[model samples]
Target: MSSTRTTETNGAEPTYKRRRTQRSPSPQYKLDDDDTYEPYISVAQRKQAKLAKLTSWGAGSDKDKANKLKEEEEERQDEEREEERRKERARKERTLLMEAQEVHERKAVEDSKKTETEKAEEHDAEILAAIASRRKLASDLELAQGVQYTEPVKTSWRPPRFIRERTSEQHRRLREKYHIIVEGDDIPPPIENFTDMKVPEPLIKFLKSKRITKPTPIQLQGIPTAFAGRDMIGIAFTGSGKTLAFCLPLVMVALEEESKLPFVRGEGPVGVVLCPSRELATQTYENVLQWTASIAKEGKYPQLNTLLCIGGISMNDQSHVMNKGLHIVVATPGRLIDMLEKKRFTFDHCKYLCMDEADRMIDLGFEDDVRNIMSFFKHQRQTLLFSATMPRKIQDFAQLSLVKPILVNVGRAGAANLDVLQVVEYVKQEAKMVYLLECLQKTPPPVIIFSENKNEVDDIQEYLLLKGVEAVAIHGSKTQEERQYAIKSFKSGAKDVMVASSVASKGLDFNDIQHVIIFSMPKEIEDYVHQIGRTGRSGKTGIATTFVNMNTPEQTLLDLKYLLMEAGQKVPPFLTSIEDPRAAQGGSLTGCPVCGGLGHGISNCPKLEDTQRRQMASHRVSDDRGGY
Candidate 1:
């Protein structure tokens, strides 16, 4: 049995061995079938086989795996670095673009400014050349005519012998005749009529043509002082012929100076008359044209030229007129300063500086501009300051600008005309319109209603129109055309009532205004006087009614009370008895001594407190540091 089992085992073993040989043949196998024999291979052979397989797959031995991992890491790092480089490149590109744009805008603005500066400089140069050529032509014309031109020598002024010889009785009579009060040395006596004022015959004929036989008080005294080349402050009411007073003397001196020296183009004006408003400037210019016409017609002052320099008009036209040469310039301060800045005109040759409504000009914030203009004039030039009221500050300005100025007060300073009957009606703010309507019904046409602001004026005007009352409104906000039309309509009796703001409070001449209704009184007493002065002008009696209310400031109420008492007007008991809240709080009624503003004392002044606190803190720090 063993022999037979052995024989069978040997036979099965041969078959099994043959099968195994057939399945796993040799170490070197086909590359395509290597994976088929991979499990049956030895551990070392399997590793070698794996290495060969990995080599084929681009990952062979451990060193090869490390090299592959290193290559992958290096590739990943390179890719990340490339992405960072791309981002950095994009950021640099954006930065460069932004910097380029900013540089471009700055360059554009710089170029524009440079161009404007160049154009202005070129225009100035052209003007200078034209002036030089005109001067050369004048010199040549004089040489051709065998005439020697010489600058007139300035002589010290002296009072006329006739004025010096006047007796005390004559002076007293002159003062009583015109209600004149003169202060300072060498005050000339007032004249009775235009004929006695020593006015030239031609000007007298011009005056007669206009049917102005009698001289107003301001003209009586102001004309003589101006003719004598003395600085004068003429205080008179509105519509008191103040324009003619300054105009006659200005024309006479301009003509006399022209006769001595030929009119030189671009030499600036010989006389400068500054008005506070464009309308006032226009009115003064019209008077100048009228006064200079007779002389111009007689060919005595053929080169006489009067120019009006005002805003809201063509600057080119004004410059053209100035280029032609101006003997007298009637201008507003703003336009005059603008022209002066452009070098279009100069004040070097200005012999007379006349400021009509001088106080109003200062109140309108032209004080600095006036000072700047005066700086351009020589000390010998005469200054004539005319206003209805002069405040303390305005007097100080006069002292600095004028040389021994003669203060001529025709009437009481800041006093309304006694001829105008003043009445005060105590009414609430809400009831103002109703009371106004009732007053208007009783009063006559040609009435002026003064409001505190533009909106109030507009509201009053609209209300009146709705009530079938023909009314117009004038204010600083109104256009020039609108203001002129409103004034014209009122003057022509087309509009029965004219509502206005403070713009019409000063220097406006309304001779036919029968009543001035103060719908709202102003804060300043001087303004109140001027508003009432508008009526009762030209020797005509008128009425003024004011509405008082709680909204009115305590200081304004007190001032109005004093003004009414001084003018002999009836003051209501409420106004006289109202206690000032500021005074009760132990505060000063006067303005701040440091900043000159109301409602606060110098101790509480913002400018003073801040400066004092900063100085105190600095001193404390210095003491703590042992005076370092």
Candidate 2:
């Protein structure tokens, strides 16, 4: 046979072939032959040979057995280690559980011994007792006389006829300038200046030093009324100089009384100023100190004494001050009540009682506490109530607390400041954050962002911080120190934005605030007015931007629209067209048809169940009679 084969190329068809085969070689009986035979071995036989090579009996007999035994020992050791590790883990878990149970049981036992109210009461008692212990009674001689020192009686004198005529002319000018309305017989005329108001020479000099030459409308009216020794309710816009309006009269009266019959130690303060918040009390106290210092110069009125009695400070320190002596006490209702109850001080000699931010005090449910404090005064002291707005509740309170008070409404009650350029933007609730960010970019620094609650305030503050905005927050939950620091930081230009709750709505005087942003509409219209009032103060123009959404209460929106219109600001069509969501959803005043109850519908009525049962019973009785 041919050894080569011919193949077709490309498209050619012819081909030739030759078979190629080789004969098997004969096996050789030699060691070299073993190597050759191994390549030809079957898979099963080859695997058998590999197993034999690896077995102890096949190679290095004793050494292989020793290696196998060593591996077995290692396996046993590893198993023991794993078992030990699992047991240790179980032991640790058990120990932790036991510790937790012990801690829980101890807490449970302690909790069972006393209720939360009892624990709080006990803590309060300890604090009060400590304060009482620190308090020292007045010297026998001082208490017996009931005055610091007796002064010769000076004959009371009235203003000269020319001064009275000038005062009348000034009053007319003030009424026209501030649009002030006064109602009551013998209404005192507003003063032309602090000098005409009969403010002490020292205070007038102090005011001049501070460059406060003119009197704000509230001061012009409120000061004269307060000086006349009549209960007065002064209503003015926030930052319209209400603090000085009431404080000037207070200091004047206290100084005059101090000259005649000074307060002795433990005789209690001659004047008590109640504020709604600790911050307000502190602010008022600082202002009072400034005024007192002006009058309390060396050898001037025997160094008039004042003290701040507020919470979050050591009561013992306050007690020590009270024991030393305090002519004036500025305090919150709760702390003042606590001091009065503990006898750290008395209201027996309290000749003047002023409720600053009286509307807020009443809103916080301090009406009863205020009433209790008033009971201590027995209505003999002059009560001066000052607020930014005059709600009906406030009017009711004034009726009960004041004796025919002269209602001094600076502008319309609960109306926002005319100076503020109010703008309303209709936005979705979810898009408020984005809108706020956009607003901040355009608005200048020294902005105040008012949130509806503390949590929102914190959230907005944190978001601003994340966006590299210099911001601080003030709310009721913050300590007094934190609140003070935040306000100071904002005032010093260290912070640009302040996120606050309604805690900052009353009596906080941020003079240079350029913008007020309402992150959420307040539940009350008065609060909205106050929030915006934070800006446009002290004769400076400001902008107030409010974000309104459908989720906002319909009544709040309506009230806001009315307020905006009253302020002569343009209202958006969306705000005008917004209907109450609840009403649109078929909510009605119809009563339950089954029971005529207002709360529920017929489907869920308890009476319906009984009625159905009775109807079924009647049907069964009718079927039985028909069968008979």
Candidate 3:
């Protein structure tokens, strides 16, 4: 047969076949292969010719390149299929992860909805395990290994016979009656009568002479604590015999030392009393003298001499007294540190350290000075810190300075003295000065007027004097002599009223202060407490009338309101109407836990700020030393 089969097979368009339902038989596909007329030899020659043509094209034409491109296309298609499979697996994995996250979230919500008891039960085992791990960590850690500790001298004296006579139940009743809150180990029992305490007959006699047959709440507890030679922090309202509580013990300790071995010239000052102000220092010095001078005059003991060390006083005079081996030294921080730094005197034999108006001292930037003074102690001393307000700052300071001190709080420290009738009166901002005259008429002579500013104090004094009111003014700006004169005049009833700044409000116990008029409301509730505390002292009732205007800060008003409510006093409509959101969140009653400022809390406590600033400053010093 010829090589050609049909014209249609010669590359004419193949006609489409229809109407055949049966599949093409395998015999028909085999017949087409066998029908070729060309011999096997001819076919082999044709394949060889085609192979040669392809090789020549590879060298000369681009068809060979096209074949290579076709192979690359097939490879790319295979790779794309593999990539699609990978993407599918990844999507499935993501879906599983999302489902797992949803399950965790649902479990967390279920746990959160559980009651605390239920939750505790659920977590009890894990909690115990966590605690055990923490305990293990603590056991494994050795922190502050380089810190040194020098123990103070332990007290050898026991409570006097009177303190022991009362059963623990009777003592508890006495503490409750006096609202005496004590915190420490081994607290001695409080006494009712002066004779209950173990004192020289002279003190009992002095007490009798002064018509002070019984001790005040602070005196009831504080004297016994000091007598036991224990370090103590004494907190009581103003005029609660706090001075006597510390002063009497100081005298007794000095007397004991003076009798055992008489202090020669340049030898002694068995105790030191630190005060924040010159007035307080002088007052304390006089209080010490009150006991010592009486004892010496009665020929009951050796004479105990005390020196007053304050600024604006001649150092020569102080040195003269120091050279005589003083028995007690009452000093302000500046003068005391000055005397110590100058080596003018020493605390060598001093074992009793008393800080009077301690909160005021710490607040007045005297903390560093006080710390330096503590460093001057040669032995384990008995420290007594007395303050009207027992802020956390004072507590922390007492902790740092004293050893295992007893806390004798007559009442909650920041509380208003129930003895004082606190009256909050709303007045116009412009009419406060005029209303002051009416407030003064509420009580007779021996009145105290507290103003916020020094100039205002002077102005108020002048205004009162012009209105034919006998008024004396005192503040920090005044000369010490002037302040002393004003205090003396007020105490002696020579001045009907004393117009003073807050400087005179603390540690000044004037006789029969009938009323306290607050011409301007103080910003801090603690300050207000102290201002009113100057009156209502020594079992006598007095009234505190405060003039509040719209100019006062809302926080201050809120503090006044809470204070009034707490004291069972009447709250003015203005104060009652004022609302603060913080009151809803544990702010109305507790005030600032750190400093006792009712206007703010721990977040914005001024005392906290001061403490942090001081700490930061100290850390800066360490940072400079490259302690990191």
Candidate 4:
């Protein structure tokens, strides 16, 4: 045993068997295991033994045990809060050195990663430039091939000289074909004439400020019923003051309940307006603000707080605003849901809910969001569903939202404000731009050319400007500030022509829009109604033209026919001939014998391409594949 004194492995330190040079006198409770040979220990001795055991294990062992104990202590700090204050001095000292080292090491790693990221970006840029160069060469080669080899051109076709111009009688018949008629005599005037109706003065004032001297037939009927606290499903032609119908009631009801405050007014939104698109939401908000602001100016009205909660805005700002109350909020469904989840706003106190362009809201697949929002309201709120035309799907939403709503239609195929002169012209696809130029040269000022896509909108605007026409384009891709400037310029008579997409379709209040050119046929009949609606607004008469081709799909034509016919317009005999090429004009929905109700013949209907569509698709595909 004397020759076998214990030593540490590798480093030759004292081991378990080694004896201390000096040992304290054993306590009365000390055990053999507790010390070198004691078998029992006191509570104080045990605590000391634990501390010593931790220290003796390793340098890091003591630190880790201290950290774990500190974490446990922190967890119990609330119960031991007084004791935590007593131990604060030691607590700070224990973590101070480690925290500093960790911070320095973290910063060093971040700097290294940043340098690597910048280098990678530089490398990618060079590779992308090389790829672009190859794409450009390919496009050049294709253009050269097309120029070098050309097929014999087909003979240009011309229309019969007998159809040079349509007589007023022919125009009337065409309108009849589409069931477009001004049946003012048949449909009773909306009780707009009733002076004693309990309609709110604020709404009446709003209408006046907008320079609306009279309500459209739908508004006349719908407003009074809504004012009576009745739910309403209003079916009317587009541009017939439907917005005012629903908006007026919403504003009035909201203003009625809002708490008044001076200077630092709190937000207490009593009404909410939901729309499909941001453009529509913004337009509706502006309209509401214009009238509401005027009311505030009179010093009699509370500063009605109207907030906009649409997507594509700063979320942080939206969250902050939601914490504060709002008097009225105009929002698209998506952003409103996000805010609701984040507890930014509540619809609990919503006394009035308006779905402007209800058909569009449904068409855009917002029904589920709308339904979820409706559940948030406990009591049945005054609901209004406004649409240009009532499709089956929209009808379902209306029935669900409104509680026995009064159905109001101006007339059969509801007259789309007779002020709009709708005409259709046939043209070749390649010649569309030239035809547009011709129209500009011949048509009067303040014209709007509507395209379905932004690229086309930009192209048309640029082409028109190149031809020395003062035109500006507005689309979703443009910044809100840019859209506002363009709209202001157009309205101020500074710009003569505005090339636009569907962004200019709904609720945009632009006065003196004289003519609307369908640069491309709108996708839906309801959209078509709204597109032309822009022209003949606020009791102003306007002209609208749509270019149709023989290549226009029979289904599209039929849809157009049904849309017009539903509106009480008569279908053209030629359109009827589409279903029966050989049969005389008959009002029968015979299965198109061509493609067995597929709307095309086996050969022609299955894969038919109109001249313009084919050209546009080819050009678009080429541009995309050529990496333009």
Candidate closest to the true structure, highest lDDT? 3
Compared with the true structure, what per-residue lDDT tens digits does model 1 show for residues 1-628? Answer: 1122223544565322222223566677578756655435685786577668877787356887888688669978999999999998888778767979999999888777765435444444454343223111112333355543232223333445676788978987878876888876766667676666656677678878866788887877778777777778888876677888887888877777777777777875888999988877877887788778876776655657889888877877666566676789999988888888888878777888888988766542565577666556543477788887775445555654456678888776566788788888889999999889999875678899998789999999999999999999999889888988998888788889999998887777774788899999776666677788778877778889999888887756776766677777887898778664456645446543333334333334443454457668978998999955
Candidate 2 residue lDDT tens string, 1-628:
5466566778687676676678899977787646555446795796577567777355567877788678669978999999999998988778777979999999789879985555544554454343223111122333345423222112233343565676656766768887888766567777667766666778788888877888888887778777777678888887788888888766766677678876677765778888988878888998889988877774566556778888888777656566665688898888888878888878777777888888666542565577567656532567788887766434554654455568888886677798999989888988988789898865679999999878999999999999999999999899978998998899889999999999888877875788899999875666788899988987788899998887786656766766777778998898778563334445543333322233333344344455457668978999999997
Off by over 4 Å in 2: 1-160, 163-174, 318-320, 578-628
State the displacement of the C-alpha of residue 409, model 2, in Å, after optimal TM-score superposition. Answer: 1.2
Q: What TM-score, over all chains together, does every model reach?
A: 0.65, 0.65, 0.73, 0.59
- lDDT value, candidate 2, whole model: 0.73
Model 4 segments beyond 4 Å from truth? Answer: 1-190, 193-195, 199-206, 259-267, 315-325, 413-415, 479-481, 559-628
Candidate with top TM-score is: 3
lDDT of 1 at 546: 92
Q: How accurate locally, in lDDT, is each candidate?
A: 0.73, 0.73, 0.77, 0.63
Q: Superpose all Cα atoms of candidate 4 onto the true structure and report the RMSD in Å to 1 decimal.
A: 26.6
Q: Which of candidates 2 and 3 is the stronger one according to lDDT?
A: 3
lDDT for model 4 comes to 0.63
Worst 10 residues of 3 by lDDT: 134-143
Candidate 1 — which pairs collide? none
Residue 623 error, candidate 1, Å: 30
For model 2 the TM-score comes to 0.65
lDDT of 4 by residue, 6-125 (tens): 666788667454334655897686454465565577967976776788778756656787896996687577658877776886677777678799999998886777654354444444
lDDT of 3 by residue, 338-429 (tens): 88888877877788888888876655377557666866766557778898887764576566546667899877778888889988888997
| Candidate RMSDs in order | 24.1, 33.0, 17.5, 26.6
